[model samples]
Target: MTAPAALAGFDEVEAYHDAWWDEIVAQAQAPAEVDIYDKDWRFLSTVDDAISGDFTDLYNDAGEGKLAQLAANPVAQWISENVTEAEDLHVRVTQSHTEWAGKAQTIEESMDSDGFESMNISFLHDLQHAKKIYCYPNPFFLLQVQWPKIYPYFGPSVTGVKTLLHLNLLRRYQPFWRLPADIFSKTAWAQDFEAANWPHIVNPRGTGLFNDTSMHCIIATRMGNFYDVVKAILEDAGLQLTATRWLPGDEQPFPEYATITMPTLIWDVVDKGGVRGKTGTLLDGFMPFVRSILGDNIQETKTPVPYEEPQEYSEDKWGTVKEVPAVVWYAAQRYTTATGTGQSGIVKWRKTQHKAIASAILTGGKSPGWVNTGVKLIANAILGYIGMIFLNPGLALGIFDEQIEDVILAFARADLTNLRDEMGRDAYGEYWESSGQNGFSPSTLAAFRTGQMAVQPYTSFQVEVVNGQPYWYGMHAVMGDRVSMELGMSGVLYTDQIRTARLTFGPNDPVGWTLAVGKDDDDTSPTARLARVLQAVSTIAQQIAVQS
Candidate 1:
């Protein structure tokens, strides 16, 4: 009554596949949250903590299990889906390879402008072109074989154009195809022709080349012997290249795609009901404003007064203690006051008591007494009177100045206080009240903002002088993952402050795109403006620091 040995393997595979499907479906249905941050407007310190604590927990509980199931199921389905008609799969594979070879020719032709000579071939081009060529007829079969095996069951259930687009995009980078090959085969290249036609054949066991998650893994596995392939291609084409390796076991096939939830803070700050129209509302916009002030000659100074011991008090017979009053005295010069008793002949018990006492003073003895102590007190009183006469308008102006400066510095220091106003005013007032119909509370908005800022891109300013004058320079302004902004002069300002100015972009040469500093040069693009502010702020900060 025992089951056949062959049936045992099939049973195990079926069970694994079923589990994988369950995992993928669970992942797709799981609830996700995204964190938003006002990188330009607020400084966030607690973001990393929140990500590790709250986000990580949520991901583990709600996402990981389901994704695992989905990724696992689809892999098992691949063998049954495409292996049934290996002939069709081979024809599709051949067409794909031919198309890829044609595209490789185009890539080589493009490289000619940059002095690039074709050398070793790129598997990415081959895969991408192949997918494009056989997109319509191949996706369903390919997905059955590739998706589950490569991404686990969580790979998107795409067919036709969508499938082609995904495959083509994935293959252009080499990171995508190499994942399956690395997990399934010992020699990825040995299986290239077979995989080019039937990717499932490359990794029938669903273990080796099929599981790689990182793009780098694909590159390494495909062209490990030729370290110079990527370098040569990118260099020859004059393209910047930044590459890194994937974590160990990361290349293994997973059941689902990692779902990144948007942080509540993004909605709170960015929603119409949120703090819209407020200064520094747009995280991207606020950066330049901050640089405008902090990048300049802004300095902070602190003067410390030595602590003096408090005079002790004496108690009466009732044990009620009373402190004696002390008076602060000031004098311009050392002058002794003498008390004499003029009585006809009675030497009024003349007791000469001379005690040394130093007066508390701000300045050395100089000028008139009125100018030393009296002037400061008089100035203060006059200023107070003037303030009253102006009905606190001047005071309001002063307060406004301080607050504005605070906003700028808060951004520069990336202080948490920046989020306070954003959460209270933007998220709570605008987003929740207007958009969410008051369903969201201020506390919730605050939490959301905190989460959002955690993931936003961090920017740093770099300054360089062009045309023998100073200008702002910055990088990685708006978004992460290779997005950046720069500012430069369009023309000479010809103003009292600056003799001349020009605008340009940073992380790029300023040869053809330079803008004159001050004149009405329409070439003063956003990048140039950003550069200007960055340079100005940097200059100001350096000057202030030096002066202090």
Candidate 2:
């Protein structure tokens, strides 16, 4: 009888494997820009730059030689010719930490008691003796004492000593172990040490402990010395270092090295958006979104402020003066709280409104139509509240027919069930049939669709303008399926792609408004600031009307 098909055989299915491999390669090579924008609207250019630099440097510096060999002696060729030998070499290099630690200890003891007069001399001796050693202490400690004048000659003396110590220790304990005795000769070692420490001796004004230039200098110096050491050792072993050396004319090495020094895409959305190369704007489309939320008694004039008091009848005092109603500052503070920069007044305001709006939109049973209606209602409510605060009360009452009385009438007129259905359809797919399966109650579904999943009883509602025409927007909170509390005619306004207004309502009763007029001609008008403030108030009133 034929043996039943083994499960292990399925793993080697050629077609299946090939398809997966293709997908993997495509994913690896995908353009990076797609992931540059995160959910919170934060830019990821700086993070990408940091990760890319680290990844490329590690691969090129450590694996370039092996990669080159793989070209001439392909993987298939190597496997067929010297698989066993390669396996043995890999095994030898993979020695256990315990075994290596013992060997390192022996070497350390051998060089420990060398009683050198100066710290530099003792350090050099220990470094030479160790198969692998890393100096943990800062090099500045020695530099300050041995060469006091030289301390100021180097860049900012923050962590240079620590870095030098780390690199020197790595040379002694790790990479140096790979070097043969001929490469470890006194002259080569000294040259390597000097090169490794030279940059610290030069530029010192670093913003952080590890400056980029300083790091580059350290790496180049150490690598150059290491190359020399390896070259000498290879010659002694009847192998030519020149054979491994990537000559100046070599394209392969140059590309790999260039990759190491490539500037990362560092972007600041508030300033310049993307990686800059010496001149010109680095970031693209990075201007801050500016809006005049509220202002009063403001006037625009071409005339500059007087430097001195004007005489009683000075004719020079004639200039345009436009009256503004009130003044309100609306700003976007992008400073990160993670960096310990506490939230600015503007940022705090944004957070409050964002949370409130999110809560209001996502609080009801699951129904697409109902959900959309709810979202619109919630937006309307938010906008209405904002409008009421800034709009004239007489105008607000006319629009709603009774101001306070009409606010409740509008909420009662809203088809909560239909609104829930619309919201679900807009937010979730049509496939979501409210089957009462999955323990989903109508109210639970509504809440989930609206994003009001919290068990603590709360109300969900919103207000928004439907057409290009201006309208009242507001919301009311309810508990136990009944309106327990309401906020009315708080703010006003309609949504325009070119012009937008935002108002933030806080628990502490703090209120703020943002009016973005875009690049319109009216924005520069003498009464622009006051107009903005009035617009914000109008929007706030509309929000309160719906919310209440």
Candidate 3:
């Protein structure tokens, strides 16, 4: 069905966002006097309006066929609208020190006055110093003190903080890849079931879960960092990067991954189980785990098929021809333990039947010491599972699988290595170091430690200072340093680093007078931090209510 005509047009979307922001500001300015519930409804209404317009459905009627609809989520819409692929992107990692270091003594002396103006002046100085370092004027500094008096409930309303966190989590924990058709393809798995005289055993339909449409919305919009770009370059060169299979479901929605009966590699068994001799066929020997959601009807294949000329062998860490398994047993989908599906029959079926099948195949008939069996018990903390993807056309899901930090650092190292190679002794002047102390200047840290400052801390990379300036380098959308300003600072001091320089170029701010912060990841800016704090508080309150 087409979207309703009342849906907002493209030109009106930005205006709609502005109106919502204005309303949020007004509500935050006088929350006690405003109808908060009504405001919430209005906010939801705005989201509905933003999503009402027809969007390009990436996944064509994938499982439950709601992937397209789910893509209309506010975060997805915002990312789709705002973030575009960059071409010939040349990010200049510059070296420059923060201007605040010079004014440190002045701020400290002003703090001794014990007057309100002194505090205000110090705060302004910090903001000015912060602007020199951060991409925008530090909003956290502006709002931290004034929020209590001028805007009581302003923190949670800020955009981009939670989204950035979610993006980081996805990039860090659940990097994605497309499922290739040849090795673990739907066609091959289905053929195996039919060949085993269990035609009715495995379902043939593609769940469309790993399809580009389903995974693209979750990833491309989230990972626009330089690391992601480099990873893309590496993947284009045929490096199947391994990432944690953090998604908590044992049962794979894809039918190809439903059963575990592929011809096992000798090296694979030796690598996983440690070298032990004497066995019939490789398949019979490696049936340590196998469970099917289709009950006893789906029996394990006893007779093993010989390797019919292994086609696409991937190189392992040692550069050996590694036969990439069609589907890794442990890296399947899993669901919550909560048994009774809530009221709706659809929910019940999805929770019970679909999940049971997914869980069953995911477990693969739990053998001793198998991790997939208890996947739901332990959350993402257990980083044992590995998520793999197929990068073939029409089969790839757009998800980042590598740690962004690692990618960025690798780039820096590569760039530095090249520079050193080119200049020899000339490049020895500057170097890159990880930002350990949450990307705060010594003055900023001291101020925050003493409760004199309320700005959020950013964890960033630092390069050596050359010619009195610190070098700065980061992507257009960088990860925010997730330290809470409320928490007391407890880390070693770092100074004259690259982070003290601008991380991103503001397209709109030609003069750079924009008083915003956390534009990179959009999480640590004062407003973003405030919103995060408020959300955290709200969550705590909700938890308390539930406990009570």
Q: What is the full ranking by lDDT, best candidate first? A: 2, 1, 3
Q: What TM-score against the true fold does each predicted structure earn?
A: 0.17, 0.15, 0.15
User: Residue-wise lDDT of candidate 2 within 1-548, one digit each (tens)?
Assistant: 75457745665587689998677544433322211112222222211111110000010012110111112223323323443421211100100110000001110111135542111000011112221222322322332243221111122112232233334543433343333232223443344333222211111122232222121011111111222222111211111111111112323322211221221111000101112223222111111101100111111112234333123212323212111111111122322335323322222111012111121222212223334355556655766777878883222223442223322212101122332443453432112111111122222232232222211122222222121111111111100011101123232111111123222222232222222321132223466468545744654454234223
Q: For candidate 3, write residues 1-548 as lDDT tens digits.
A: 86665664754787899998676444322211100001111111122212111111000010000011124345334434543343110100111211110111111112235442111101111111111111111122232332211111101100112222222322332234222354234555454323222211222232222321111111111012212212222211111111111112324334334542321100000011112223423322223223210123222223444443233322221112233222111100111124311211111000011100110111011111223223322322233232223333233222422222222111211122322343444433322221111122221111121111012122432221111011011211111211101011222112111112221122232211011111123323596469546744654454234222
Number of the top lDDT candidate: 2
lDDT tens digits, residues 1-548, model 1? 98999999999999999999677544432322211112121211111111111100010001000011111223223322433322211100011001101111111112257564221111111122221222211222333353211111112111111222333333432333434423223354344323322221111221212221111111111111111212222211112211111122324222132211221100000011111223432332333223322421111122345533233311111111112111111111211223211211111111122211111101111122223244445545666678889886233333233222212111111122333333343322111111100112221222222222222222222211222111111110100111111222221111101112122111222211111211121233586468546744654454234222
lDDT of the candidates, in the order given: 0.22, 0.23, 0.21
Error of 3 at 115 (Å): 46
Off by over 4 Å in 1: 1-166, 169-185, 192-459, 463-548
Where is model 1 poorest over a 10-residue stretch in terms of lDDT?
55-64
RMSD of each: 35.0, 34.9, 31.2
